[model samples]
Target: MRFVSKLTMALVGALALFGVGFATVTPADAASGTIHFSIVKGGFFVGAEGGNGVLEFRGRRYPLSIGGISGGLVFGASQTNFSGRVTNIRRASDVAGTYGAAGAGAAVGAGVRVITLRNEKGAILRLQGQQVGLMANLDLSGLVISMRR
Candidate 1:
């Protein structure tokens, strides 16, 4: 009886140690890239925006297309140019996903804007730049991005 109990305790300890070691293992670090894009938006109650951009990653440049729509209290029109860093992407294609934002802001003539958005694939975009013309909005917006073939 004593020998059986000792063996059982030893087995349990070994399994716990193995489990902890496995749990402590970490995943590979994700890569990041730089991007620049410009979008023009306008509407009354509903708004639409589209533009094109380039992603510089791993010593290469990839062309990207951007489009989105917003619904709610949206009024006016404006053009915004954004330049920023995209992180948590393994490759250029990972940057092609749907990113959504819900907020309210207005721009008259010239204004500066900063925003952070994330996608389903765990890619995050930290963007900030200048907005020109005139625009105002309070709505939910979803932006879709795709690689130019």
Candidate 2:
């Protein structure tokens, strides 16, 4: 029984040390608030999208400028209005960066899409938008977003 108690105490001490190391290695990311944006896009084969938006963080609204380009079978022209919530936002500048994704989607007359994307700054955006006009099989990627002055 004495030997078993000593072994248990050693195990507890090891776990405490491991917990300290884990906390030091991985710090928690601060979550800020939701962001709202609207973009208008148009092109044939190669296309561009841009518009204005606002970020509602900490009871304040900051305006943003949205811009992007899409390639691969980007047909016709369309306008999209999107709103999303951002998480793991450590700083105000974290929201401004390039978020990459290769998604093929089509919209005729009217359509809706929900997408979740993570940027290089470790911020994740859950976006849902309404698309109008027409588009087909657009493999969009390298979408860059930035703050508007």
Candidate 3:
């Protein structure tokens, strides 16, 4: 346990020195990226969501895996096809962190959905997508995002 704690601190110190994930991100550090993700979720009053996505930034590609939980007056199941831009990227690793946002969207027939989220590292994502199926109510969701090698 002592060794693990020391290793963690050293790693964080190294990253901070190089200004990776431990600094405030400014517009100057922002890069434009696009991501396509798909999610499936279901439950009654409580729900879970999971999905995978690919991000294209500055001629490089990064794979992202996502998982999250949400609760509200939620019921039934729905799938969403999302495509959006990631912003405020201070470093490549900045995109790999938890993000939370509250949004309202429904696809009763034809619909439009948009949400904005920011993570601890100051990365922001503005996403717009289409939701299919039925699930209703307002909810706050926290998404844990990570980069897949």
Candidate 4:
């Protein structure tokens, strides 16, 4: 039993060190891109955009604005512009799935559905506008939506 406990402790320590290293990893290596998205009046918005920034996701730095949205609720027709270092990229589909699930789990999560619908609409608008190269979807959590150009 003592041996087992020691082994477990070692493993836990190693994991903790790995986590620290992962957190410090930078998210910018190449010239960052742009990211543009709108946040519905009521929902969580989280994302980043800029000429260069650091995005730590899944223990990797994948050139921000490369992925898409994560998850959350979206609504209405709104536009938010931000110019900065592309920090992270999360796929819209992924975010939708996560948020949808969470919203469903919560008793008052129906609001998520409405927000997500708005997000879809906003995404469509962004796509139709032909703003792809420097853009990405976000969850609107810690997102700072601002206009640049």
Off by over 4 Å in 1: 1-27
Q: Rate the local accuracy (lDDT) of all candidates.
A: 0.91, 0.79, 0.79, 0.31
TM-score of candidate 1 on Cα atoms, chains taken together: 0.82
Which 10 residues in a row give candidate 3 its minimum summed lDDT?
103-112
lDDT of 4 by residue, 80-131 (tens): 3222223223332221211111222221222222222123212211111112
Over 1-149, each residue of candidate 3 has an lDDT whose tens digit, in order, gives: 99999999999999888877744555675677888888877777788899988888888888889889887766777887789988878456778889886755455644567888888877788988888878775777788888888
lDDT of 3: 0.79
Q: Cα deviation of 10 in candidate 2 (Å)?
A: 23
Clashing residue pairs found in predicted model 2:
none
Off by over 4 Å in 3: 1-24
When sorted by TM-score, best at the front, the candidate numbers are 1, 2, 3, 4
Q: Candidate 1, after superposition: displacement of residue 28 in Å?
A: 3.6
Q: Give a tens-digit lDDT track for model 1, residues 1-149.
A: 99999998898789787774433322365789999999998999899999999999999999999999999988899899999999988779989999999979999899999999999988899999899978888999999999997
Superposed Cα RMSD, model 3:
8.0
Provide backbone clash counts, one per model.
0, 0, 0, 24
